[model samples]
Target chain A: MTDVEPLAVTPALEAHALSLVREGSRVLDDVSFTVAPGEIYALLGGNGAGKSTTLLTFLGFLSPSGGSVQVNGREVGADVAAARGAIAYLPEAATLYGHLDAYENLAYFLDLAGRRVDRAALEAALDQVALPPEARGRRMQTYSKGMRQKTAIALALLRDTPILLLDEPTSGLDPVAIDEFHAMVKALAAAGRTVLMVTHDVYGACQVADRVGLLRGGRLVGSFEAGPQGRIDTETVHAAFAARGAS
Target chain B: MSLVFRIAREEWRLWSRSRVVVIAALTIAVLVGVTSLLTARGVADQAANRTARQAEAEAAFFAQPDRHPHRMVHYGHYAFRTPPPLAVFDPGVDAVTGQSIFLEGHRQNTAMFADARSGADLGGFAALTPASLYQLLVPLLLIVLGHGIVLRERESGTLAVHLAQGQSGLTLMLGKALALAGVGGLLLLPVAALALAAIAGGEAPLAAVLLVGGYALYLAVWALFVLAVSLWLDRRSVALGMLVFAWLVTSLVVPRIAIDAASAAVEAPGKIESDLAMLSRQRAIGDGHNAADPAFEALRKQVLDQYGKQDVAQLPINWRGVVADYSEKKLTALMNEIAEDRMTREAAQSRVVTAFGIVSPALALGAASRALAGTDLATHHRFLRESEVLRYDFVQALNNLHARALTYADDAARSSDPEAEARTRVSAKAWSLLASFRFVPDPASARAARAVQPLGLLVFWLAVLCCAVVVGARRLRP
Candidate 1:
């Protein structure tokens, strides 16, 4: 009798043995990672450790030199539009058009992602992101960083893409805003969207991530699985960071 | 809502917020309005003056007293060029070129009385016509509206979010281009209204429609160029500076270079030199007024032989008048040769300038505008050629009267005998028989056909810029 391996389910996103080079400098060395659906994966790394490079590689801007990145079982480079349809991104400093109102910002971004939403839906998404009702029609220039981050999250909410790739999602937020962002991110993971966030703050990563990975020199050198409390132990993540720093 | 329209709306919102852009566009509109009004008034006044002078010339021609037909031939006629209807908007070449020409027997005259001689600040380039407004100011305003179109997103880090959200680089580029095109369309509306009003008011050619359309495409080309540079450049200030440099090169530097190239490629001699050459060539032929010039000896023999007479007195017709007619024919032919050569040289120069449209679309658009308005060098050449035709017909008709209406004895004896000179005078009714001058501009199809090349160049520029935008989009990176 022939033995065959049992197939479980395709990951929401999978980057297997990915390698990337920029301007003759190797930026990402053989990196393998996967984020299952409904899970929030946090990547902790220092500057120049290829944290953003991995995200960009998944975004199809930087082609992987060694392996592949797949979202919803479709390869990143094979059909970028198809793979892109399933992901929403919020950068470190999430930027909304300063000249556009929050409503317009949401509408424009949602439309770009092929999700047509009316004003009511847009306002609903803003509310979902805990944005104030009064800020919906005012230009984004008047909004604070937290409000801008809310607007960006609201775009992700409006786009309804299944995969969310966020870079420094909770950076530059006040303590209260940081707690609120953590709660909102937890709520997003509970609602069945896969979240992959890259950040320097280990506590923020431990607070919301179902699983955590430490990226150093573009490789996933260490990982921590979430406890029943839905948090990776900060002490273990810190030890990993310290060990990598010492070496 | 269509995606492109939404993009355009976003652009409009952004522009509305930019106080500088709003003020600049409004100022351009107001200036265009003022320029249109001034151009209309100026065109009307010039047209009226030309009409009046033409009437005076015609009245003076027929008011001649009884005189020898040959004497009336030397009286000559004057032709005045009429401004076309579209000239009220474009006023192309009218201020610099002469508007009146003199046509006399034996010698062709240069057009004289240009408006520049009055020195009313033509050199300032503040004439404020619709043509100058589009050619000079509208593109600047477009740059103000569009230079930050893409760079702003890049600088603010929104472009990465956009690209990561499945918005292809091509889509953003297209959206920004649509936005800039919308602004350009908005700016073009007022000038288009002015042109449309002129066309509807009567006496305007269908070619004026081409003028309006040409300006639209011209502005679109500007939009495309602005968007392409914005896509490629990394900073707003750098994009703006580069776009302004491009505008200066296309609108000012390239045109000047094209003019220099044209001047070098073709020799349009100075007025004095041209006149001297014509005089020299005319002298090489016999003087038309000298009845006994050796050049007319063969003509005299032909006339005498045709009449079957051995002596001048035995001929039925006047030998002196016949020699005068023969000399006029020889001189007219020589004048035609000289005039054709000058026009050919001038046309070659214009062609050289027009060919430079490959480098700068402003040259193409300016040439198209002037051609559509009937105020180009070609139009002026046509006027001259037609006026010369009229001159030849009238002069030859009077010369025919000289050969037919009087006797040879009377014509020759009139120089020595007073009664014979009195008898040699033909009736004034003969002067009335001379035809009036009329300038016929080329047909619409003909002029529009010639305009096809420049128009194609504009399209070519647009296509190339579009391709550049696409190429820029493919490698769109912050």
Candidate 2:
């Protein structure tokens, strides 16, 4: 039998020289990248490196001063609602209503996104994120940072959109919780979900991401991709990241 | 459900859970109920008292013994200003202006026995009426509860999430505003019930309905105002400060400023000045009591010529009664001229004050409320004018009796001879012939019409805010 090749697929997310000017300062300058369908791409940068700003542009929260960003082949600015409909966004240290329980917050956001989930399904998503069963019903204000992060992650998962944009996804989590979160993200990608996460942790990015893009001064400085071995080298990516930061 | 409904439901949920919001809403509701009951009772008592006193005064006047017609003219009747059925909701100028006027011949008495003169101190607070609660306190409560409806979403960073969830800023703002309008609707329940009661109690249905509708619109103005301010300002605290400041200016400060401004601009004569002016004008017509006064010499000559007699005693009718009848016509005309001038100036002052409603919506709402309640200055002026008409008609009827009923010989000699005095008096049965005064209120349609301009101004305010909301919603972003 003759083997057939796969058709070329559109990128799930794209930024063509995306530049953002806010209140007279360039936040993202000539930044460019693309995440293929179902690929897990991580953007690594230090503080004020415009990583979160990049995520916001994908969510259509900020308009680019130059160039453009697209989600699912539609320009974000042209069809913001359409773009937002295709993606689930988890902001850095996402805050759900402090007065509501985890289940209530999940229900509210899912409803906002025009999705309905049964109680069992809600519990399954929470369980997948390793949130404690006892804590799911308590107000988020009573939650610790890790618990809150898990609930927010569960909310994003329940959104069930094809594209995911996570900002500082594993922030304030324990080492064990971080590893669990990374595994969950990989599982989602394996299920053909597009994942774009921005973070400062090089090793964490190298561990779960199919490719790592290094960003500095609001520009994409370098990129690392996993070879046939299916994993990128952490040492190489770290050295390159550190070198860019020092420069 | 739709996006707006979802957002509104969420907002409603949050507010329901908040202790401060729940407590404040409950407190205002309670105040509404309490104030309505108290004001209703007060209005009923006042109406009953005036009605009873009016009947008693009329009965006593007709119970007098046989007397001269001029004596019956001096023993004039009392006209009590009956409270409109809706006065319980908005007392308007009733407290400041007199509720009763004493009517007599050859004299134009001012209205007397104002409620304010009876001295019930409200501790410097606005009189606690259902209208005041709806106009002033409800809006303040809405501000306290909802100033942070949109601000909280932004501050908590949920606004970005909401947008990313495919909800536009417009929907988000509209949803929150919808929730606030729902609260305002809840606050309107007591006022609606009060208005309905007024209508059921035989008040003008159109006016009562208009009163309720005006309040709903007024509260909506406040709701839109709160939402617009919340959406426009960035910081929650600053938004709150701005909202409270706006409340102070529109609700309290602007109303007083408008009054002061109107008073200054129109320069209405005070009661003392008007009375003295009326008295001074009256003196020029001569003492109506003295038949031989020089001012009436021409009048005396005219009457004698008309009768074809050289002397008053030779005439068929009593000359003194003729002089009294003729002088009264001149005097009433003079009094009316001055009173009309004063009313014209007062109406102008009212127009100036109401015109300021364009700047402050509270003034607009207030003028509309009072106009609909039939408690405004225009209605009071109607009472004054109608009462004067009754006075003139009744006094002339008695003057007619004076001319034809008694002989000239008896009238001229009555001061010296007791037998002549007895003969000068006609039967007390003549007093029964005079028509009794009953104050006729303006038609319900007219009262409703008076409210149209101010109501239109309220609608203008609401339209401007709605436009602002549209602009605000369009400009909204996280």
Candidate 3:
């Protein structure tokens, strides 16, 4: 049951009027979005802003009250296994199996996704993630935040899925690890993979994301598109974020 | 399948490092070895002692001086039933049932000197046999080892990673189940080795195989049950609580309730009532010793008419011997009817216990284990039945001796004349003609056949729990 092979030529991600209610409160209200191939879409929001809910709905972890979430162009929750197969997710905590070493955890998770890997492949993934060879055989309990994140991204690379979802991937990372993560994120986008990073780090989003959107009160209040622009207009970005709804 | 094994391999490595798991496996292994050795030795001692006692009783009976046939009938014989070679693994109902029985003419006796009559602690706290260890403690160990397979994953957030990687809930549950079953199999290796040794030493091979297979099936069931609860529950403590509760209800509470329910469902008449029924039937057949009684007087006239004799002196066969033979035949038939009725009621009671196997596989395992070991109630019933048949045969042989060896003129005057008394006494060789009571245990095929129903019930439980685990696993989310 764990082995879900992908359908060829599926889109990265798509959502249509996704409405969600939790505990009798409208969390995500008719929110619709898409992440194109080779694009990094940063979703920004305040607390109680339905940012996590939208991510969960997209992953098929939460059933939408009204509307649909699609990953790899397949309807979410309709065929959750297939949908999950088309995407790689890196949680905020990036908790790997504590009892298992990095290499064992990688092989197990990859095998679960129906991917066969040899020792060389496993070593390559760890090397790509910049995890020290010594750490590959050590228990994950001894790992730092940056190392786990690297391993997670390395797993996502092994997954080879076109879409990646990062839930505050840099939340607890140090400044140097954050820079390293941003570089990895930019590299993944450059390699033509769609990445949707759900975060509250406004400055980090402006720095790395091809486009940034402010989500508040169950809606995408504003969209700020940017290129390798001169400099981010912090005042203007803040003003747009401060606007509540229907602007 | 490969992915499931991969997951299992990882868990096994973890278990190896887990002090709690290693300690538990070692403890259960020790218990199994100790219990098997002690129980086997105890049962062997019991069989040897019973055989020796039976031999002595047979010698005493055959050594009796020449005596009148009727007097010899009252002396009776004792029959001792030996435990089957596989009794060490299960002991079954042997501890609670008496191994020796006293057989006599015109009367049937229940097997006495049962261990239960003395105390329940004969083998310590519920007769701690190998079967009990498999039924009670192994499941407890399984629960301790695996009740957190899924919950720990969910709590530590590995389940999210797995799910995000496209791993279905069913696959995860099955992998955990396989891992738990592997541990159980490892722990049970000693008992399996002992069973094979028993088979090599002349125990029924089929029965031993079934014993091993049945215990494996029983343990698999617990593994699936653990996975079912682990998937359904969110908290490790809660899952462990529910699994332990299930163990208690199925293994301990249900067996006792099954017995009480069976006794209530079937009304087996007590010994006193059955005795009264046999006595009434005896009275109806008339007294053989009283010639003045109307029933005997009518019989005497009929015999006289048949022989065309106006008196006892005219008949060629001794009329007293004829009366004894006639009374013995009628009384044996009446006693058989009572015995058959009692056996039927007991069968009905045991059936009730078997029917309860649907909700409780523990009871089913016990029943199958007993059946394979040849120590169940069915085996006990055979012992009693065979003893009665032998008793009737020997008694009838003696009655025939009385009719043929004694002349009517000499037999009737035996009490009045010393010469008649010496002539009426039969040769001592007549006692040797009777065979000793030999219990023929049913073949392994028959016992294994009887165990099929309970084994099927165990399979059904595993199948159902497996389904539950799959269903519960499918819904796993972060």
Best by lDDT: 2
List TM-score per model, in order.
0.93, 0.95, 0.88
Report how far residue B153 has shifted in candidate 3, in Å.
1.9
Q: Relative to the true interface, what fraction of contacts does candidate 2 keep?
A: 0.69
Write the residue-wise lDDT of candidate 2 on B1-478 in tens digits: 3878878888888888889988998899889888889988888888888888988997898899899999888998887887777888888777666678888898777652222211111111257788878878898898988888878878887877787788777778788878988898888888778888877888877888888888998898889988888888898899899989998888777777766676677666666777788788777787878877898889888888898989888988878888788889999998888778777767776777678788777778888887788778787788888888888888888888888888888988899999999998888888876576666556678877888888888889889888888887775666
- Please tell me which model should have the higher DockQ, number 2 or number 3: 2
Clashes per candidate, residues 3 or more apart or on different chains: 0, 0, 1
The candidate scoring highest on TM-score is: 2
Model 2 chain B: ten consecutive residues of lowest lDDT: B116-125
Q: Higher TM-score: candidate 2 or 3?
A: 2
| Each candidate's fnat | 0.77, 0.69, 0.81
| Sliding window of 10 residues with minimal summed lDDT for model 3 chain B | B116-125
Candidate 1, B-chain TM: 0.93
Top DockQ prediction, candidate number:
2
Clash-forming residue pairs, model 1: none
Per-residue accuracy of model 1 over A1-247 as CA lDDT, tens digit each: 8798867878999989999888988888888889999999988899888888888877887899888999888899999877778888888788889988898788787776778888788877777778888877888999998899889888877778788998998876788888988898888889998999998888888888988888888878888997777567998888889879821
List chain B TM-scores, each candidate. 0.93, 0.95, 0.92
**Error at B34, model 2, angstroms:** 0.9
Best first by lDDT, ranked: 2, 1, 3
What is the alpha-carbon lDDT for the whole of candidate 1?
Answer: 0.81
* Model 3 lDDT at residue B206: 84
